[model samples]
Target chain A: MIEVRNVSYEYIKNSPVLDDISMTFERGKTYAIFGPSGCGKTTLLSLLGALDAPTSGAVLFDGKDIAQIGDENHRKDNVAFIFQNYNLIEYMTAAENVSLTEKIDPLPYLLQVGLTEDEAKRPVLKLSGGQQQRVAIARALASDAPVILADEPTGNLDEDTAAEITKLLCDVAHENNKCVIIVSHSAAVAEAVDQVVRLSHGKLQEEV
Target chain B: MSIFKRAWTYVSRTRKKTASLCAMMCVMLLLSLVGIMLHGVCMDASQNLKEVLGGYVRLTYSASNDREESVLDEALAAQIAALDGVADYSGISTYYLSAPDVQLVAGSFAGQPQGQVPRFVGCDKSALHENFIYNSFEVIEGRHITSADEHCAVVSDVFANLNGFTVGDRFEACLDSVITQDEAMPEEVYSLEIVGIYTIHEGWEITPMTPERDIAENFIFTDMQTADAVLLAEHGVEKPFYRQGVIFTLNDAERLPEIARSMQNMDGIDWENFELVVNDKAYRDSAASLQMLEKLSLLLVIITFSLSGILLALVLTLWIRERRHEIGILMSLGISKVSIWKQFLLETAIIALVAMVVAMTLSVPCSRMLSEKAFDVAETMAQSQAEEVHDPMADVMEKLNPTADAAVDVVQKDDVHLTFAACITIVLCTAGIITISVTLSAVPMFRMKPKEILSDVN
Candidate 1:
């Protein structure tokens, strides 16, 4: 489980991208933060993932401040991130990219993400956008971390592929008892998650 | 996955980048290797020059001085011999002796006397004589005239044969009129026993005016005491004297000029009466060429090594910048910055080691070609400078002592060879350079936060 306590972030003086925002993510459930572009949806997800420290507040994991746990250690042991642009290492094969977080074989995870053995072995650069996104998701799932922070997990995929990826994220939370937080503007992604949180004007509110 | 596995994946899969880096490394390493080998060769040549020149400083009365028969005393010789860089010093005083009872070798002119006056040269140690040191004279039978011999002599083989003389043969000689023309000779003649017989590899020019005593075969070597006793007995001279100055052999030939200058400024010797002649021209000329080569080699080493390090750092930095996106992704996957650094280090190390091996394999022939070219360049530079600053006295000195010419020949023919120690030095230096370049490139990357790196989108 992860929580943000009154987090505020500023890219420049007097210009806050995220301000006084608070949220909680629990295991065995999936949460989606939905907002327009430049609304700090991804910034909030980054704070929760320990990728960036909040300027004014704290991000906690399992009731302990993630800062005390150390940013790198928290990221390594508690949270895994999936970037919007499918930031897979181009030099690695699809399975190798999936295997970046752990030393185990990545073939089973790649297959679970709907990639054939042939596609899994191919370089990640050679894969299609949807397939690269699948590799990114597989990389997140391969880690033993308790939380997944995905920024625009399917933002580049087709409608059907986005729907399939959303279902996979939901299944990961439900079946593996893991916390899944996704930042996206897609309504379908928000509809599939267990809870929908809307962010606007540097603040967050749950869409009951 | 493991860091090595990840690093290997990038290095093996990115074939073009790895090859480009390897080629660059090989070129730079070859240049440094050539520099090292050439430096080694120049050092070896300098050492050989020292052995050949055997720096000898002659301190005696100047021929143009107004004082006739001015004496170079034993005390002065002792003071000079005690100077720094003086390995050993010997006094040379020649007395022309005519053995009227012996059948001496005939001179060149047909009308001259059958047996000419031969030079009786005395020194502390006859073995250290310039003729023997230069290999122009070698004792073939019996022992040399050492300092212990009081009345012993080493004659030339030609002189011994003409007189039918052998070792232990006693001979008597009157002081010839050449040195004592103004003074009367003593009633009793100096008697000496032949102790050694020497053969001449080189001899003097035979001209109508040339004296028999000036020929190499007619020269006789004796100890200082004998010459001193002859002087005391024949001329009634009370003090030990050297008509020909003392020759001081130096330990280091390179320091000849410095030692010569220092001797000129010493307190005891009267510089006005005596002239110090340092035979350093041969060593100076050859050492100049070697010193030029050494400096050039040093500059080559600095430039190539520095440029190589900068080039490698630039190449690796650009590559790391291009891989910023992948770096962000790795960091997002919870891989620590240290792990990522280790991976990059592994990648570059793999390529650098392979490049070093390839360069080493090709180094022998490359060093040979490059060193030869460098030597030619340095020689050309030295020759041009030498032509501009010509020493007319060098020819005179060479004629006086043929050892200088032989030394020049030896140095010019010296070859450069790459030794194991040089190779090891190169390897250790290259490894240090590569590590520094890698660390320089990696430091700034890891200093940044994962968020900033991910935001680059490059």
Candidate 2:
């Protein structure tokens, strides 16, 4: 479980992006964080993924603060990140990019995510938007980390492909018994997850 | 994937960038290698040149009479040779002679009637003079007459051909009537056997005899003791003595004048009739050139090294800039900044390794070829200078001074080796420069956090 307690963040000293935000992500469940633009959705994900520290807060993985355990170690062993850009290395093949996340054979996971063997062999830059997003989802599934923090996982994919990718993350959490937390602006992504939380004015509220 | 594998994959994928970087490193390393090799060789050559050419001085009798000449004898020659800073010494007693004017007084007193006013000349050899050491004479047959060879003689190749005299042929030196009239002409001839034939190197303005063909052809080298014996017979003296110059050379030229002054202060050296002559011009000329070349090599190393470092840093900065996205992605992979920087170093270092091998392999043969070319140029220069040389210097002074001959060996020798120490230094310096340049270029990239690296992107 990842716990964000009394979290507040700011880029500039005078202006806060996240204010006293607190949340908990449990194992064996998928959660969707919905927010409009500039609502600190990416900033929340960044802090959860250990990309950056919140200005004042405690983000704990298994009741221990992630910062105290070392951000690099926490990110490496606990949290795996998926970006909206499908941030796969353009110079590498899809499978090679998957290999960066896990020591296991990357071809299986890439194939599992609907990339054909030939497509997996081609440079990720040659892949289509939906296929690249699938590769990003497949990479998070392939990693040994228990927590998957994705920022706009299906932000660039069509509804059908986005639903398929959201189902993959849900399956990754339900079957694999991992915590999958996603921040997105799409209603389909929010509806597909087991839990939905809306971000407004640097605070999270349960969406009925 | 492992760090090395990732590094290699990137290197293989970026073929154009790697090839261009390798080419630049190859050129930079090659220049450094050549500069290092030249630095070592120049130092060795300078020392050897100085040893062969420096600290040479000639002492000769400038006598006006028989009494003055007698005082500059064999005993004084030995005393001068024993002085401090005198490394080695050789002496020669000259005798006037000519063929076809065959009644030439082989060995007779001064002011005595000359047998046909002899035009040929002979110099007795005690030790190897600078002239012979510097290839003024090239031995053609048999062996040269040393101090130990009493009755042996070495004539010019032209003289040997003219007389059809091969090695082991005997010749007679006939005494004159002025000495014969006083003593009933006992043992009037001295026997000499031809032991060697030699030719002179080109560019020689000096010879043991004047311009007369007969004299030039008849010039001979004999043992100093043999020449002394003949003079003893002419004067009807019981003991042999020297009537020629003793030239002394030291190991270095720093004390050339000091030794000369010391010899003058020595007892019974006949300083009034004899004076010391310094012959350090050749050594000075060679040292000046070496110093100039050393300065040039220093400048070349500085410019090449600095320029190489700057160029390497520039290209590496571009590579780092190009890989910013990769750096960001790798950081997101939870790789430490240090490990990521290592990957970049590994890539550039791979290029450096290949280029180093190519440069080192070429440096060896190129250094030797450069040395051979330098020697060839020197020989060509000597040849042109030879054309400017003439026989006008063939006079009494030339015969007394062996250095008057053209010393082709002093300028023609070109020997160099690519030493192991210098090669090792080149390798180390090349590696150090590359590593430093890579590290310097990576600093800005390494400073960025993963957040910052990926922040500007969507």
Q: Which prediction has the highest DockQ against the true structure?
A: 1
Which candidate's lDDT is highest?
Answer: 1
lDDT of candidate 2 over B302-395, digit per residue (tens)? 7888888788788888878777878887877787777777888888889888998899888878767765565455445544544344345465
Stretches of candidate 2 off by over 4 Å are A206-208, B62-85, B96-127, B140-143, B161-196, B203-218, B236-242, B253-270, B361-417
Model 1 clashing residue pairs (backbone): none
Q: Residue B286 error for model 1, in Å? A: 3.0
In angstroms, how far off is B121's CA in candidate 2?
A: 8.2
Per-residue lDDT tens digits of candidate 1, residues A1-208?
6999888999887788888877778999999988889999888888888778899989999889998998889988999788888888998899988888788899998898788999999998899998999999989888888898998999878898789888998998899999999998889987899999989989998987
Tens-digit per-residue lDDT, B5-97, candidate 1: 999999999999999988988888877777777778777877877876667898878766654445687788888788889888788877666
Model 2 chain B: lowest-lDDT 10 consecutive positions? B101-110
Per-model DockQ? 0.65, 0.61
